[model samples]
Target: MSEEHNSRTAAPASAPEKVSLWQKFRRWPLIARIATFGCGGFLALFILAVVGGACLAIMDPEGTEERAQQAEDDRAEQEEQEEADRQAEEEAEREADEQRQAEAEREAEEEREREEAEAEAERLEGMAEVPGVEGMPADEARDALEDLGFSVDFETDTEGGVWDASNWVAVSTDPDSGELIEDDSDVVVNVTRPEDEEAEEEDDEELAQEEAEEEQSDFTITQEGGDGWSETTVEFDIADNFTMNMIRNGARRDTLEAIEEALEEHPDSTRIVIEGSFPMTDQYGNTEDSVILRVFYDRETVDQINFDNVMVRDTIWEIRDGGMIHPELQE
Candidate 1:
């Protein structure tokens, strides 16, 4: 009995200890336990998701959005540069083509002009080169040819117009001295008067005529033209040892008038040669007075020198049609 009483007294003390310690937990709620378990599960899931996301970010694809954007920008810049270069090249090519075209046009124009000039020259030369045309008087022919851009060399035995003997001339074209000229070249003419007869009777007759006619006189100058050649001749009287200045103005005037008439009749197409003779008087004593008989024509240069180096005659030169003429006195 005593033991049972002691046990009962100890039991009360233990009960208070148990109630205080378990009081809050027992208040409990089934709802609190369920909520705790749910919260714990949710925290575990959230931690797992965060770790997985970090791993996925580190192992991203080879072509990232940032890298793709950078590549696109680089490509665009390259394209822009290439386009600029291509445009510049095109512009340069176009300019070069234009320049070439202009040059070609200019060359063509020059060639055309050159050909025309050559043709004109050829026409005139052909007319001058005809043989057997020597019979034509040179003075009248020269005037006709000069209208066509020919340069003339003339010498007359008589004071151009009416005289005892007829005048004669030798004609040539440019490049008279050396190599032949092209077929188309202008005629150069040379004319000279016939020598006065050397016979004593002739001299006396001339003196008597001179005494009778106080003033110098001349016959008319005449001209004739054919296919390409023209003839001019004048009849005149002249004294021996007379200078050009000494020749009476009336005689010269008559010859000039006739020559002018011939030129008026003939235009640029034909070649003319003036033929005549003149007695040269060297009052200066620097030269000898002699008869200078020649054909006056356009060209005057000579390759070979003959007969007293007289510009009037005794030398031969080239003329129109690239022909050569060696002057010889009429038989």
Candidate 2:
């Protein structure tokens, strides 16, 4: 009975207690409780918002598209500001990195400068004494270098020495020639010497005397005790430069090797030059082949060596000052 009375006492939809949200409010307030028609809960508002936006994009439905466009413009503006901020931070970071690199480079440069200065100071402070000859005679230089307590050898243009005439003997020295050497240590200095002109002059003279002596008819280069005669005849032309006395004396020799050794030993000797080869018949009909050579040397060099072929005036074989003798040619 009570339940039937309560159901009959309910208010109608038009009553103030059951008023629709639109009828209750002239405008919605943020703090006010909302009222709505009980159609499909509040889900119809969200669906309407989406459908209205889609319609507006196509046909400007209900001015919903205008509101969405405003929202998109605001979002784009915020993204642009964020991107700009990121770019500014990156630029600042790049500048800081450059500053750090520049500072490191500066420190390295200062360190190099300091090291160079130290090397310069060390070079200036050294001053020491060195002994022994300083120049280019290999044997002499070696001796000198050794005396200075240094164990060093040389490297030349060749294993021997340079051959150029105009070039001076230039050598590189270690520990510098005048530089201060370490206490009790060795000092090395490189020295070079010129070619010996005197030795060459002597060679020319000795060769000249030998040639001149060989050409004299009175001279013979035979030893005693040959079956009647066993001797060689070296006939050479006198170069236009020989004196009569030089020609006579050049026939004698300090040493006489076999025909084979003579030619092999002095392949370049003009005194041994041959015009032609032929056999000469002795009065007894014995045949002998004589060799010929040219004399082109000076007599001065021969005198220096106290050397000359033996000179023979008599037919008997004998050794004399730049002369020879042959018993077979006795008058």
Candidate 3:
């Protein structure tokens, strides 16, 4: 009975009960126990995270690669959106600039049109219609133009200008008849002497008598007798080169009578002469005189000549020779 009890006690000693993990932890010191619980918790969390990751990978094999591609695609789309916005901004700025340029051009065109209109209006203000002066006397034409607030300029067609403008007629006008001209503009009246109507009235007998009289003497005098007869005396001693030239140029007894009358008006005046000048244009664009005719007059014995019903061919001397001679007529 003693041996049986000893054996039972030895069996109980040899197999002291194995401590559980919780019992072992509880047996440690306070700090050690806390450290062991924390370590165990961290290890369990790590194992659970690894197992969850493996399970997700097994469910969708290409999930990580697809996520990476989606991220890359999103980044590319954001960049494209920024580029589009920039392009749109640039286009808007360009359109605005073009619109501004077009507006400026339109404004400039309007201003030019306005200026042109103003100029046209101003031009029309100072304008007038030129009056018809053709076939009118020079004085009448001058009066007509002056009445319309225009100055008159005279141009003569005949080589020997008229001594009096009233004796001439206007053939035409510069700027023409029935045309528009500026206010106070110069109107040029082209004048010419009227045709000699009496020249056509000379019959053949009168012409033959005139030829016979010219052939008779350079100068002639007639005296009437009491018996209805006339005595004619021809004087060749009074004939001079100048008088012969005057006769050759169609001057008659009336021309000498007219010169004599002019001399009678100014008996004290010396060196009476008739002069005619024509305008000539030089190579240097200068207007100059070309003397056409010249005739010297004498006062003595001029009244002895009869000049009834005759035509004078030239004008008498009006001014002195120095006043009448042009620079081109000088020696």
lDDT (0 to 1) per candidate: 0.50, 0.47, 0.63
Query: Compared with the true structure, what per-residue lDDT tens digits does model 2 show for residues 1-331?
Result: 8888888777455745666856656465634534433334567988998888677677855465667788888999899999999999999999999999999999999999999999877864543445434445555555565665567545444356444422433255666665556534654444344544355468899999999989534322222224533223334332221453453233322122222233344333323211212244779999776432222221232123322222322211132122322332222
lDDT (10s digit) by residue, model 3, range 58-151: 8876995688789999999999999999999999999999999999999999999999999988888978888888878889989999888899
lDDT of 1 by residue, 82-186 (tens): 999999999999999999999999999999989999998776564443222243466556555455445555444346543322255443433353434343455
Candidate closest to the true structure, highest TM-score: 3
- Candidate 1 regions exceeding 4 Å error are 1-60, 65-68, 71-221, 225-265, 281-291, 296-331
Cα-based TM-score, every candidate: 0.21, 0.26, 0.30
- Determine which window of 10 residues in candidate 3 has minimal summed lDDT: 231-240
63 in model 2: Cα distance from truth in Å? 5.8
- Regions more than 4 Å wrong, model 2: 1-59, 127-193, 197-331
Off by over 4 Å in 3: 1-67, 128-154, 159-181, 191-331
User: What's the C-alpha lDDT at position 195 in model 3?
Assistant: 62
lDDT score, candidate 1, position 198: 36
